[model samples]
Target chain A: MQLSPSLTQLIEALRCQPGIGPKSAQRIAFHLLERDRQGGKQLGQALTKAMTVVGHCQSCRTFTEQAQCDICASTKRQDSGLLCVVESPTDVLAIEQTGQYQGVYFVLMGHLSPIDGIGPKEIGLDILENKLQQGGINEVILATNPSVEGETTAHFIAELCHKYQVNASRIAHGIPVGGELDLVDGMTLMHAFTGRRTVSQL
Target chain B: MQLSPSLTQLIEALRCQPGIGPKSAQRIAFHLLERDRQGGKQLGQALTKAMTVVGHCQSCRTFTEQAQCDICASTKRQDSGLLCVVESPTDVLAIEQTGQYQGVYFVLMGHLSPIDGIGPKEIGLDILENKLQQGGINEVILATNPSVEGETTAHFIAELCHKYQVNASRIAHGIPVGGELDLVDGMTLMHAFTGRRTVSQL
Candidate 1:
């Protein structure tokens, strides 16, 4: 069936979202035009404003309206000598939600994917290296995902920390806190067994 | 963690889409600002344009950029005297996709939900009554859904047709074409049995 030109354009534009398909795009377009034009206008204005004002934080590569993010600018965080590196801004939010980490963060934006031509520079690793080489950091934590590319990226960052003479640590890999052992995947089971610690350490 | 003001607004606006929640909205907002700013701008423009241009079709109440929709304006559709009444523009699209029906359509936009303060006038039943009373119509097909509200709406429309002395027919209720008998819901099974017809009728 033929749609109006503006409707077609709206559907096509909506397809740029991560999980949205043509069907979903069409549904969203119709919904906006039919039921929620005011909401649609609000969303459009918000998008324009965000695109205009939000940019990568100069210090940590997280999204921010200013040069440095709130976390990077704050003096209240206790562990100023420790840095936690992650693959994305979303990961930073996830870690922060725990309320246990007092250190600052470095966002890589993406993992190292050689097949996709994403190298160290593409993910802001050079900036991280520069931060480490400035000589005040005591420890570096690798908090990338458990994927192969994440592992490669973490190893590369670990080597950089070693060269800078800073201690390096990887986030533990095992069954999640609420997960059943029988349901845990084989790779995670093996990692858990190998990374097991004494009761005193716990 | 606290997000920038514009970033927060963008995330809130993204929740206007059908299934998106807080986490999905955040992900979509970040994706637009970080990776697909150009696409986001295009979407914003499309939304603005669509909102400015599109309005309800005069004859059928479907979304259109003009006074009449493409289907309503077309001369090739055979059944001008047959009106298929349905509950939303999306349902009109669903029926049109079958490529079987050549009749004109009347979009109710909603069902008769008195509890929600939606009565006959709210769903354009008055306009439908006027169309039926004008006397060219040979048949009115009740193509509303099979739920209780849908049935109530369909029956109401059928009564309107009877008042105008125009023929009224209900869309058949039965097992879906590819559905397994054992897997069909009890309500649908009862509807199928009750709606059964002779082979010669087919």
Candidate 2:
């Protein structure tokens, strides 16, 4: 039961990672010491550097070391006059991987969770409203997740777009391509049916 | 896309932990940035401290920040003259949890792993043999895992124990106490049958 003091602290600190529990924390600590000390050192340095340097982008609220994020600083993306709003920086990565959208992004950092005290101001909705009022954006695409909070957030932003007289559209909700319909949940199936389009005409 | 440099480095560095993949790395990074900045900072500091300071106990080869581990440093455990051989420090923790043994430990750090270029010297068998030759230990319990490599390593060490004229024993391998009979594997069942003793006499 009496492990080394620093090893115990390592285990305790490793539990801070999402989904990592006590057993996993211990396992990770032992593994790093036994097999990957160099990597462990590098990870420690990276964490310290990132925690100190990484900050929210002034224009989009995505993580960046500079005042403005790379996407926001790009003239090409800014010239497009299109802004796709998402819930987190990872969503920006997910959308960027597709190479489909040429627009810049607005990251909310989180969805509105009223019970948790998250509201228009908490998720940077006030920043978003200011951007909308400035009037360079031609359209705002609500690409938040399909959860209930995401939907509510999209609706709220859509109303904001209406107030600014800018166009707004929600991303489609339906069965994913190449997935079997039988395995799909009822809520998703319902969304697929309700959001049907005139595909043949298009 | 172009993620922030520090954020990207943090995600890449997080991959060093066992079982964490790209998506998990990104999720952890975002979770830390958005929710647990304080925990992330603490983990960073802890990792740096542990990786630099923790070393193997000289007496038992388990992790410690000093010359010997807590159990190995204790006079009572040293007087017991019982040394338990195991594959890793975690195994030491596991055995200590049972509270059925009052012995010091000799951690092998790994099993035989010959295909991976591991040998007797690599797992600190040289150190173990030296301890056996020192003439204080009365019994050495081979508590390595039941896998093929562990068995091979145990057999190899049993020979070393024989040369030193030290008493050696292997821990019991059988169906777990709370496990159902139908769920026990064939190999474990065979071990149970082969190692069965007269319960009334025991």
Candidate 3:
């Protein structure tokens, strides 16, 4: 059966979300029509308000409605002359969830993938360089994912940092929490064995 | 970290969509804040437009922006003597995808369930009764799922149709096409064997 043009368009637009396929989109659209008018209105308002008002913090590149995000604006956080760089705002959230990192973040939006035509300019390497030049960031933590493109991006960023006279280090690669050796991927297993620290030495 | 009241509220409001877990919701909210301004605007416009415009077709109880949805409005659809009854708009779409069924549909929106508090009135059973009384419908196909609740709903509707002197039939339950008999659940196997058709007149 033919749906209303607007309804069809709404489903099409909702398809952009990562896991929402055509069937799921239709189900969501129908559910929106059937059950939750209030939810629909709230969703609309939230989407519009957030996209219009929220922006990147000038210093840390974290999202903020002001000139700087709360972390960047606060005087209380220990600066530590360190900056932790990540791939996306989602990755920023993941790191923040750890509660271990005290430094600020610089989100690259995506890793550089030359094969996919994604380059330094596409992923905002220039922005990182500019931020580094603004001073006080002595150490850079390259926390990109442990994929090929991520590794390439990290190495490129490290070389760039060295040229700018800044110290940079790639985050450790190993088996994740609760991971068994048999279940871990080959690269991670190799990394874990190679980077193993002796308890007796410690 | 504590978010602003408005930001927190907006994030909370985005929880209505299916498959959007708390972390995913937070990530999406952050993505809208960091980038995707145009996407957010389009999403809002699409949502609000669909919600304000789409409603149930008066006759079939399916979603539509018009007084009657396309299926109900089409003179070409075989409205002759058969009506397929289904649980929701999703079911309507599922039935339509077959291209085999020529009849129009009557959407119940829900099934009969007392524990969860869904009842006949909630699903507009009386409306179906009224339509049955108006006649011209020779067969009513109960196309609800094979779940216990669906069976209960079908039985209830079938009884009502019988009271109105109308023919009612439930869709057969059996092993699905390409299903392995060894892997089939015991109950389904029993149903499949019992509902098996006679291939030879031996």
Candidate 4:
């Protein structure tokens, strides 16, 4: 059917979302036009504001409106010499939710994917290397995902940390706390076995 | 964690969409800011354009950029004297997709709900009444949904048609095509039994 030009434009624009398809885009467009015009206007204003105002934090490369992100500016966090490197800001939020980490962060925003032409510089690795060479960090934590690209990025950063004589560690991998052994995948089970520590060590 | 003010505002604005809660809103907001800034900007422009340009079609109350909707303005439809009354613009799209109905539509956009303070005038029932009284329409098809409010609106419109000396008809309610009898609800089964017609009559 020939939808109005404005309606069609709205639906097409909605498809930019991660999981939204044509049908979902149409549904969202119609919903906004029909039932929530005020909400739609608010969303438009917010999108414009975010696009114009939000930018990468100067210190950590995470999204922020100011020069540095809250974590980078805060004085409350302990161990300023410890740094946790993550793939994205969302990962930063996830780790912060745990409240166990007392260090700072370096947000890569993406891992190394050579086939997609996403290299070290694309994910701000050069800036990370500069930070490592500047020599304040005592330890570097690689908290990237267990995927192949994440592994490559983590190893690359580990090499940089070694050159800087900083301690580098990867987060442990294992079956989740409530997960059953039978449900655990073979790769994870093998990693668990190989990474196991003695009871006395624990 | 303290998200940037603009990021938080964007997330809050995203929650206005139906079925989108806090997490989904956050996800959409981050996706726009991190991965699809161009698309986000396009969406904002689309929203602004739609809000400024789109309005109800003067004839049918369906969304259009013109005075009359395509269907209402078209001379190709077979029955100019037949009017199908539907609950929403989406319902109009659904019927058009069937390729069966050749009549023009009068989009109410909502069903009558007395408790919600939505009366006849609120859903353009008075406009429909004026159309029926003016007397070009020979058949008024009540295609509102079979819900309580839909039924009430259909009956109300039917009464108005009777007063105006016009023929009124309700769409049939029956077991859906390819649907098993066992899977059908009791109310629908009852409706099927009561509204049954012989093949010869058909």
The residue ranges of model 4 lying beyond 4 angstroms of the native Cα positions read none
Checking candidate 3 for backbone clashes, the offending pairs are none
Measured against the true chain A, the candidates' chain A TM-scores are 0.93, 0.95, 0.87, 0.92
Instruction: Report iRMS values in order.
Output: 1.2, 1.0, 1.9, 1.2
Docking level of model 4? medium
Cα lDDT of model 4 by residue, B60-99, tens digit: 8999999988887887652568999999888888898998
Interface RMSD of 4: 1.2
List, residue by residue over A65-160, the lDDT tens digit for candidate 1.
999999988876524787999999989989999999988899999999999999999999899989988877888999999999999999999999
At residue B69, what lDDT does model 1 achieve?
90
Identify the runs in model 1 with alpha carbons over 4 angstroms from their true place.
none
Q: Assess candidate 4 and give its TM-score to the true structure.
A: 0.96
Q: Tens digits of per-residue lDDT for model 3 on B22-72?
A: 776776676656556688789889998888888888888988888998887
Per-residue error (Å), model 2, residue A142 = 1.4
Local error of candidate 2 at A131, Å? 2.3
State the lDDT at A127 in candidate 2: 92
DockQ of each: 0.71, 0.77, 0.54, 0.75
- Which ranges of candidate 2 are over 4 A from the true structure? A180-183, A199-202, B112-117, B180-186, B198-202
lDDT of 2 by residue, A72-124 (tens): 99999999999999999889988999999999999998899999999999999
Give native contacts recovered, as a fraction, per prediction.
Answer: 0.71, 0.82, 0.61, 0.71
Q: Cα lDDT for residue B141, model 1?
A: 93
